[model samples]
Target: MAPKFFATRAHLLVCQGQSCQGRGSALLYKALWNHLERQSLAYYKKGGSLRLTESGCLGACSYGPTLCVYRPKPAGGGLEEAWYAAVDFPLATRIAGAAHEETPLPEEHRYGPE
Candidate 1:
């Protein structure tokens, strides 16, 4: 069984695929990290609870910069995953903040006590 996490509200997946990168996903990725650091949110990393991940194409090339957030649903409910398109730095931060309050961390983000 996968180890249990600290019960994060959400995990953010930023598209670093070729198309998204061309549209500025790299900068967006940095912006997301900076935002989390600035807020000192509880990420899976040493500092915060938000998990920032680099993902492949989400199949929204026309939209370019796209991100997907997986939020854990309440008991008896399914995963509440949302896909965002044409995301910029500011929007990513806002979305992440909100989602962080609603979802649980993905299995990939769960790390053992350090």
Candidate 2:
């Protein structure tokens, strides 16, 4: 049996693959954490929490500095995924803020789905 997890509403996976790293994912990861902290989006926070993770390759090597956000829908509505490709510092901050409900997802940065 697996241990019970905390109340998490969403998860952000920042690719740390060699390619993505070379494009600045490491610095982006730190920036995301800091931005989330300033916005009170700690993973352990009560109610809806936004968790950040350093992920391995997401199989989009060409899209370096990529990220994916996983948000579970309510009432068995399944999961929601949003992929952002070729991210820069400004877009990364927007992505983090969206996870915390501070802003809407930037469609311009979105790489998958509508």
Candidate 3:
């Protein structure tokens, strides 16, 4: 079956691969869902705003626990996607908030190994 688009063309892909799981990716995924739900209720009010997709590893295993935000652009314009790595609870929250606001992902927050 085709995937549902809960909120236009924006999507938040959470990685739940083995490496990420060991690094507490599950907790991050839960936090993202909660944040998205709360934001959707407050804004959309009808429930179901941001679409959450649980994905496998997004490479960057060195970073582990990664997520990518897919933001579709206007007609004919290329879509914008950002991959975040080394993410924890706080980082995921921020990402979800940005996605909820339909804003671009911040550069400073892009994660990776030190």
Candidate with top TM-score is 2
lDDT of 3: 0.71
Give the Cα error of residue 37 in candidate 1, in Å: 1.1
lDDT by residue (tens digit), candidate 2, 1-114: 998777776788999999999999999999888877776787765543788999999888888898998887655699878898998878877776776674457786677867
Candidate 3 or 2, higher TM-score: 2
79, model 2: CA deviation in Å? 0.4
TM-score of each: 0.77, 0.82, 0.77
**Candidate 1 lDDT, tens digit per residue, 73-112?**
7784966777777888767877776765553332332222
* CA-lDDT, candidates in order: 0.74, 0.81, 0.71
Candidate 2 lowest-lDDT run of ten: 39-48
Task: Tell me the tens digit of each residue's lDDT in model 3 across 29-107.
Answer: 8877777676662223475446677898888777868888776764648777788878877777776666666666666
**Model 1 / residue 27 / CA error / Å:** 0.5
Of 1 and 2, which scores higher on lDDT? 2
Clashing pairs in 2: none
Cα-based lDDT at residue 76, candidate 2: 62
TM-score of 1: 0.77
Instruction: Estimate the lDDT of model 1.
Output: 0.74
